[model samples]
Each structure stands twice: as C-alpha cells, then as structure tokens.
Target: MSDRNDIDPFYDDRSDPVRVLVVDEAERGERLATGLEAETDRIAADTVPTVDAALEAVDRRPIECLVSTVHGPDGTGDELLAAIRDRYPAIPVVLVVPDEERAREAIDSGASDVVVAESVSERCFVLANRITTAADRYRADRRADRQRRRFREVTDAVPDCLWIVDPEWSELSFVSGYERIWDRTAAELTGTPEDFLNAVHPDDRERVRAAMDRLSDGTSVDLEYRIRRDDDLAWVRTRGEPIVDDGSVVRLVVLTRDVTDRKERERTLSALHSAAREIGSADEPAAVYETLIRTADRVLEFDYVAVDIKRDGYLVQEASTLDLKDGGYYERTSLENDDTFAVRSYKRQETILVDDLREFDVTPADPDYRSALTVPIGEFGTFQTGASEVGAFDRDDREFAELLVGHARVKLAQLQDKRVLRERTEQLERQNDRLDEFVRVVSHDLRNPVNVAKGHLSIAREQYDDDSLEATMEALERIETLIEDLLTLAREGEEIDDLEPVDLATLVPECWRYIDTKDAALEVETDRTIAADRNRLRQLLENLIGNAIEHGGSDVTITVGDLPEENGFYVADDGTGFANGEREKVFDPGYSTGVDGTGLGLDIVRRIADAHGWDVRATESDAGGARFEIVGVE
Candidate 1:
C-alpha cells in the first residue's frame, strides 16, 4: 500500500488537470501518484520521495495549492509546515493526516488547513483555497506592514466599537480594547463579551442579544439603545464588520461604546427645534404654552414639570406633563421666607435652573425647592392678563433647562404677541364688519329708491320734452348705478357656508351667472375639482370676477381658470391688474385702489379663502391684468 500519509487516494476532479506535488515515503508515494494519473485525465500527479523535496517546491516555486503528509516515515509534518511558512507564509498548506491529532499539529505548524484522505474530496477544495489565499495574504502582509499598522491605528481611532462573529452568533474575537468598553470594570468581563451583555439590565438584554444575532448574519446595523451599568443605565452601540472565509461567514467581531451624552443632546435639540416650530405656528397662547410644557417634559419628564397660568395674583397650575402627574408641585419647589423659585421667576421674568431647590438657602429655616427649573412667560410685555410658568426637572437630565427656557422666551413672546394681535384683530374685524354692513344696508335700500326716482324723472323729462331735465335724470341714473355696485360689494360677506366640500366645477359657473356681468365679460374655466365650502367658494369667485369686471376696461375679461402653474389654483383677469403696492391692502375692508369702487370685493375673496386654509396673492397675469394666485396646496 502507498505510504499511509500520502496524497488523496481517491481521484476528486478530472477538469483542468491539476498538477499536485505528493510528499510521502519513497516507494508507496510513487505507487499512489502513478495510480492517480492513470485513474483520471483531470489529475496530473508528481511525487516527492522525501519531505526535503516537498519543502523545496513549497518554499521556492509558485504552486497553486499543496498536498503533503503530516506523518511521514521521518516524523510528524511540523518541520515541513514550518519550512513552507517561513518562505511562502500566505500559501495555504493542506496536510494529509490519518488522525485529528496529526491534523491539529499540522495546523499549529502553520498549515492553512488540514484534512484526512478518507474524506479528502469532502474538503480538498476547501483546503486548497485556504492554502492559496493564506500564502498570498502572507506575502502582501510582509510587504505592507507599515500600511497595516497605520490601518490598525486608524481603525482604533474611530470612536465606535467594532466586532466580528460567525453566522451562528458565536464570537470569534473582539478587539483588544474591548476590555474598557462600559461602566463595568475589566475584571467584570474578563472571559467573554457575552458575559458583559449578561450583566446588562434585564430589559435591554433580549434586544441586545437580538441585535448581536442580526450582526452575525452579515448585516450593517445602526441602533441606539440603553445599556445597563452597575449604578445606572447608559446608552450604547454595538457595531461590527463580517469576515467571510471561503465566501461564507467564518467569524465576526463587534465593538460597543457609550453614547449617552450625544444622544441626550440630540433629544434636547430636537425638542427645542420642534418647540420653536410649534411656537411659531401656534395661533392660540394656550396652544403655544401647551407646546412649551410638552417640550420641558420631553427633556426631563421624570423630574416634574408644572405649567402655571397666573390668575388673580395666584399661581394657578393649569397643566402639568410631569413624571408624576396630579402630584403637588409645592413639594418640588424651593420657597425661602415665603418666596418660591416659581414666584421669583414669575416676578422678575427670569429663567432659573435649580439643581436642588430645597437645599438652596435652606437652613431648616429656609428650605427651598430642589431640582427645579422655572421658565417665565412674560412676553407681549403685557399678558398683564396673567403670569405663566412652565418648569422641568429630572435626576440625570442634561443641564439644558436654561437653554430650553431660552427657547421658550422668544416663542412665548411671539405667542403672547400673536394672542394680543389676534384679539385686537378680532375687535377691529368686528368693527369693520359692522361698518361694512351698515354701508351695505343703507346703500342697498338707498340705491333702489334712487334708481326708482331716477326712472320717474327720466319718464317725466321724456313726456315733457325737456332737454335739461333729460340731462339731470341721466346724471341721477349714473349715481344710482354706482351706489348699487357699492351695496353689492358690501354684501359679499353676507352668506358663507357652514363648511362642506364644494366642487369647483359646480361653484364657479354658478357665481358667474349671479354676478353683475352687464358691463364686463366673464368666463369660467374648470379642469379639476376643489374641496371647499359651497356658498363660500361661490362667493369667493363671485367677488373676484365682479371686481375684474368693475375695474377692467370695456373689453374686460374675467377668466376663472385652474392654475396648473400655481401649486393650487387662481382666477386671473384681463383688466387693470391690481397695483403692486396695494395688492396686500386690497384684502382690507376699506382699501380699494380700483377706480370708482368700494374696496371690500377682493377683501371678501381673501377672508373666505383664508378660512378654508388657502393662500390668495395678487400678481400680474400674462392676460394683461391682475392675477390672484393661491399657491402651496396639494
């Protein structure tokens, strides 16, 4: 029989005719090599009668892969493996051994892989690729030692933890720096990284374990989560890069790092940014203050937050989004000699962040509140209607209470100003409505009488054949017509709907029929539909088209067309377009820049559109007249 530790006894492949160097005892090795060549045209075999020739070819020549015996007549294969490793360290050396013990020795001697001939084909390809790749890596590694060192240093410089594992989630090796990973001492996690995770708070263990499994399956993972510490919980990250052997995952390593501070800052900044937007958009002072309370809680809700709206000189806590809701904020306050932090803050209109309110100025005689932050709402310089308070607290919360309060100051001022302005606007709008209604009714009633009188005078002048009387009647008729147009414009706001979806297709044509088109041309163009209140939309289009007619020259054209160009829609007219400076003012009740017209027509158009959440703007149209565009809607 061939030397027991020669190359594979069975022929594995017959393609691309492999040239294999078989190292074994002289006589039996030649027999097997000869048999292998005769068995298949796919294999071309060569025999090296001693370990010496095997070592020489492996060291000096370019061989695709190697097949050598671990237990030769001389000894075990370590000497041969060592020789190959010294010269071509990257070349993977596959040892043919009869037993696992020999295989182990072969591997330790720097064979890239090991296999037994009894099942050699089951693993020949595997061993062959390993030897080839290991040899190549060995050569490159020797050449690029400096680059490898720099690469290692750079990888270490990255703040995140890195790791490697197998598809089975078994750890191969964590980096050397894994010891100092968390709040735990290195002694606490000396053996395995899993043990460190085992010490994690029970709540986070399952999730962390799951994340580890996902990482093992060749996934790029980015996650934010809490990691338990000895005393408290801290946020951490577990990240990894997969190492694939033979195009399949052989091992994976992962890194973990603490990110508590950065995550907390992000949360705070996000809350502040959100609060800023909410404050800017809030129409009601209460709604804006509500956003403030929510933001304070978002930062440190566990600490306690109280929102007070001062009424009748009493600090009435209107709402609280606290960690412990319904609890008395009194116990959380620092009141020294009857002056509480909340009171002082409200009185001075200043922001105070208290780490321990009860301990501040506390001598048993002056036990003030502890761990409280007071943000005052004194903007509008005259909420004089009352004072307000929104406070936050937490144990490990970031020291962002004042920053939050800083965010609050500008927004509160804006909200309060908005509130006051809204109230005054309501008052002014009411007075103007009253004045417009008064104008409408008086004008409507006076207009008809004037027209009737003008008609009778015209008839009398015609019957009496008096040219002077005819001129007087004609002047009166003209006056009557002007008054009637004013009355119609005033009454535009009279009938708005109770809010329902109005089909623009149905509404535009109806308005065109009702409006006074006696002096101007009107056209309705519809392509798509709009959801709006029925009568209100009709009125909006009515006033707009009527004004186009009233202000436009003799060939006046009112084109009610959908604005495909505008994000929403509009009505453009070929008349004298509204003047640039007075466009915005055109919506105000008494401000009209049109010739011989009451300005309320376009104002009615704007108010009705605003109530429906549509924006109306005036621009010059290609139609050689004014264009009112409603933009930014779906």
Candidate 2:
C-alpha cells in the first residue's frame, strides 16, 4: 500500500494503462500476467510468486488492481484479500477461484470481482474487463473526493456566505461562512433550512421569504436586506440563482455578502451632500460653523461635536452639541497651545484621530472624552468630535468629519472675502467724503484772498501800465486755474451717479470750442453715442484737446475716433508723442512734462474712466502721436 501523502490528488490515471499485480505460484502467475496483458492494451500485469511478494510489489509501486489465485505459495488468496483491504482499501481486488462456492466466499470477503479458474484460459477478455473497470472506478472516486475538498477550501476562504438547498427547501446540501456571517451554527440551519430566516430583521423577513420563493420558481433574485444578530443589525446583499435540470428547478444557489459598511457610507455621503448645500448658502461664518457641528452630530453620531474659529490668535469655540454646551466644555485655547487637540490639528493642518486620549500626553478640551477626532477647517479653525467611550471613532468617522469641515472651510473663505470687500468699500467712502470737504475748504479759503489780490492788481494796473503788473495778473490767473482743476478732480471723479446717452459727435465739438486752441485742427471722426455723465465727458474731451494743443504746437491735428474693436473710443494727436518710459506715468496725479502744466488733466481722465468701469492706457498712435484709448464701455 502507498502512503497517502505520495498520491497526487489532482492526477488523472484513467488515460494511462492500469498496472495489475498477479499473485500465485510462479508458472500460474506468469501465465495469468501474460494472458491479462494479451487481452488488452489498457492492462499491464506484473507476476508475483507469493502473497508476501505481491504485498511488497503493491507497496513499491502504484498498483490500481490486484489479481490473485485461490492458493498461493505463502498464503491463501483470502488472506491476501484481507491484508489488502486493511491497508489499501482504495485498491480493488479480484479473486480467481475454482467454483461458485469459492466465488461466493471471495465476494463475502470483499473481493471486487471473482473469476473461475476453469474458464481462465478462454475467458481472458472477461477478466481484462473486470480489472480495467475496477481500476477506472477507483480513480474516479479519488478525483471526486479531491474536488470536494478543493471546493470546501475555496468556499471557506471567501467572505461571502455560500449556501445551496433543494427546490422544496427541505435540506441544506451545502453551507459555508454561515456561522461567522449570520452569528449562528450550520447545524441549526441543516435540519430546518428555513430556520436561517429567523435571524433576518423582522421588517425584512417577508422580503427574504419572497426572494426564496422566486428562486424556487426558477427566477433569479438579487436583494439587499437587513439581518439581526442579538442587538445589532447588518445589511446584506443576497443574490440567488435557481439550478435548473431539464427545465425544472432542482436547487437554489445563494451568495450573500455583508454590506453594512457600504450602506452606512452611502447614508453618510447623502447627508453630507445635503449639509454642503446648506453650508454653502450661509452668509455668515457663525452659521457655517453651526451647520458643520450639526452635520457631525447627525452623521458621525459622536457624543460631542464642536466648532472652533480662529479669532485674535485664539481658537474660540463657537458652536457645540447640546451635551458639550451643557457640560461647559466650550474651550478657548491660544494658537500656540500644542497640548490641545483642536489647536494641534489646526497648526498641523491635518486631521488628528486619537483612539484613546489617555494614551496620549496631550490634553483634550473635554477631559471626559476618552476618544477624539479633530479635523482642521483649512486655515479658518478646527472641527472636533469626541466620545466618552474609548476607540469609538473609526476611519470612516474621520473621513466624514473631514468632508463636513471641508465644506465649512470654503464657506468661511467666501464670507471672509465678502467682509473684506465691504470694509474696503466703507473705508473708501469715508476717504472720499474727507477729500470733498478738503476741496471745498481750500476752494473757499484760497479764493477769497485771490479775489482781493485781483482787485488790488486791477487798481495797480489802472495806476501804472507795466510788464510787472501784467505778469502779476497772469500768475494770479494760473493759481485760480489750478484751484479750479483741483475742485473738478475732487467733485466729479469719484463715481458716476447718473448716466445718459451723450453723442460723441456733438460733445466733441462742444469741448473743442471750450478749449483755447489757437490753430489745432479738430476732426470728430465718430458718430457713436455712449452712456456717460455728459459734464464729465466734456471735461475729459477738453483735457485731451488742450493737452494736444499745448504739447503738439498750435497747428497740431487732433483726431477723435471710435475704437470699434476695443468697444470704446480713442483721442489721438499728431504731436510729439510721450517720451520713453513716460506712458505708464502719464496718468499719475501731479505728473507733467510741460513747464506750466497743472498735471491733473490726464489723472482726472483716468479717474472718470475707472468710475465708468473702463480701462484707459497711453500708447503711440499710428500717426506718430500720443493716443489715449479707453475700452470696456457698456
């Protein structure tokens, strides 16, 4: 007999010829071996003289079938059969006997088949058939056993529960992972296959039963249902397929997988999506923080949840769950405090999950909490959840908390931007008011003294006609002009309150007439009408035309044309264009190249353009002159 370990369970021996051992006296055994081998190509026989020699041969090699005479040299064939049966039960034995009585005794002693010695010479084919058939059947049985073991091993390693039952649901033919998944033993479900349904949640039992019925009726079923084990409920997705034989349902094959974690994740995401919408609509930082705290409480189901916002170098608790608020756990920690969980998470800009606060040296905001999960809300602050039980939070809880905090972080940033814009606008308004008051004061206080001086100059001019008196009059006029320009800048350049359609063709000619142009040519090439303050437009046109006349000499040609591609207009003059590096500085207040220029003309033009939400730039025109192009017109 071969050792069990020496056999290759997966090996198939049916394709190879069967090796047979014949045990008898020398001449008889040799004759039997010869006869068996001559009968068929499938049987290879070996002759052994005695029972002891036959046993040795069987042990030495893989012998599929054994053939022995009723009388051997060392022992009776019955003794050999008994020994083989005890040691190598898988091997089939054939006994060669003299008559029917001996054949019956061999059959009773567990011989696979018996052959009569009287017919042995002529019935070699019959003996050959018996030997080959016995060997093939034995190999097939071994293959079937191996397949069963392999199936069990594979099914056991899988996480999903696999089960099979008859169509009538009377017997459970196979079950794997039943105990670990259902929290029950296989024996409980063996006799009563329907007993497994008792572990299903009461609300889902009817649905599970209906699915089973559908499977029995040859209809495949895929369903998700909850199963209860003690006080806990788990979600399981089950898929059942009916095994059909000749168009009739014979058995049901079901694969059930635990989906509790997946279902929980789906629920958490759905809740977070809704929470994000709410948080996004909040116009204030406090409201966003409140929403985050509520979402953490509802989704994570933590014992306590809180939101801390960074204010004045401190993390100030703004919102918290009711339990935390009632317990006076609203803590205020400085940004530099490394001992606090919220501050630590905020400083690190990462999520901190502590399974047991006692294991860490850091101090928790609430000492009663044994576990905590703290997530930073960008640079704004921190969001933390705590529980009284140790190791209450898992990876999923941390991920969900981060998602909620992320939404809050975006909302906080938006609110901060709006607050900054509002403050800046208010500051600009106050500055504009003070500028208006200053302009009025300077216009009033300086104008009275100038009027007195002009009156005194008029008296002096009547008394004596001289160059000094005339120069004094011109200097007084220049100072008055400077004051008037300053007043225009302070009053009209702030913002345009009312805008009416002003024809550039009509306004351009009117502004040209107002400017003291000695001989400059005015060409209004555009008939475009634009929305603007008419007075400011006139002032802008006057400034450009006067500047061109002053710099380009008296006979310079000034062209006002539509910048169709830029959606605005340009004022170009065929004059000496701006010097190198002077284009950018031309619009600055008090920037001038002309000796007697007030330098506020171009600055006023830029301010008016900005008020109308237009962009103005100075560039060299095609006519080799300065060009002021204003774009982004409405």
Q: Residue-wise lDDT of candidate 2 within 1-634, one digit each (tens)?
A: 4434236666766678888998777888888899999989999898887777878888898888999878434546888899999888889998878789989999999999988867567678888998998988987876787778888888999998999988888788888998778988887764554586888888989988988888899999999999987789999999999999999998889899999989998999999999999998998887888788878888888788888888899988888885544663656888875468788888889999999999988766568889989999888888888888999998888888888888888888889899999999999989988897888777998888999999999999999989999999999998998998899888656778899999999999888877888988988899999999888888888888888888888999999999899899999999989898999899999998988789998998988888888998999988899998989876
C-alpha root-mean-square deviation, each candidate: 17.0, 4.9
- Taking the candidates one at a time, how many backbone clashes does each contain? 31, 0
Top candidate, metric lDDT? 2
Q: How many backbone clashes does candidate 1 have?
A: 31
lDDT of 1 by residue, 106-196 (tens): 7777776676665444445554544444445543443365455555666678765554445665444444444445644444444454765
lDDT of each: 0.61, 0.86
Model 2 off-target regions past 4 Å? Answer: 1-15, 48-61, 322-330, 356-359, 365-370, 387-392, 425-513, 521-541, 555-584, 593-596, 611-634
* lDDT at residue 477 of model 2 (Cα atoms): 93
Model 2, residue 509: what's the lDDT? Answer: 87
